[model samples]
Target: MKKIFFARPYRFIFFPLAAAAFLSLISFIVMHLWNYLLPGLLHVDMITFWQAMALFVLCKILFGFGGRGKFGGGAPCMRQKMEERLKHMSPEEQQRFKEQFSNRMCHKSGHWGRRDWFGEEAKQEDKKAD
Candidate 1:
């Protein structure tokens, strides 16, 4: 995997500063949005900056923080999963699966016709293709 552009030693120096600025900016925006929209539109109380920060944390907890499976969210994205699977496949199987996957993904007609939506029919079609 690729490391960040700056060197590793510098990341400890830079990351916290960047994260603090990002969190402050996001909190400010959320506070402004809540103040501008909710009170007038729905008669809800306007939120303070601290309230907005709390809301942000709450949302991160309820949903997910990022796509690294940190919050016990569902599986990682498809490309990562496919890459891991490909690492375990033999060379010939990997090549064949890649071509077949590309053809089906590109919606080639013979790769998957209308009848392929049905299980038995699809199996028969696959046998015939082979």
Candidate 2:
């Protein structure tokens, strides 16, 4: 209808042009930075604009750009789902689940925040106090 014609330019031309311009700006900055810094400091050869664009793509593929996921923030959704599932678990089931999860997970100190991993240790201390 009328909407189709109105949106066609945005779908076809405007978005593509905008993407190209933004990518070009990033590539230009990368190119200038490499040209200015590396050749003088490390004796590495300078790269062209297209080469810089390719490098940007390569780094994105290898290291990822760390954007939000399709469902928005990923870990929050996962944690909420986990908590929901855990709420339905029996006491024995919760113990078994905790054992299974803690055994599989080996986090370094200070890596994760505010989680009680050793309730069994506290229970043992209570037995000693009695």
lDDT of each structure? 0.77, 0.79
lDDT of 2 by residue, 1-130 (tens): 5886776656777788999999999999999999999999999999999999999889999987887654455578788987898999998988888785664444434435333455456568789999
TM-score for each candidate, following the candidate numbering: 0.49, 0.48
Report model 2's TM-score to 2 decimal places. Answer: 0.48
- Per-residue lDDT of candidate 1, residues 30-121 (tens digit): 99999998899999998889999999989999986776442335555876798799999999979977766655544546533422333354
List candidate 2 stretches off by more than 4 Å. 1-8, 70-130
RMSD of each: 14.2, 14.7
Enumerate residue pairs that collide in model 1: none
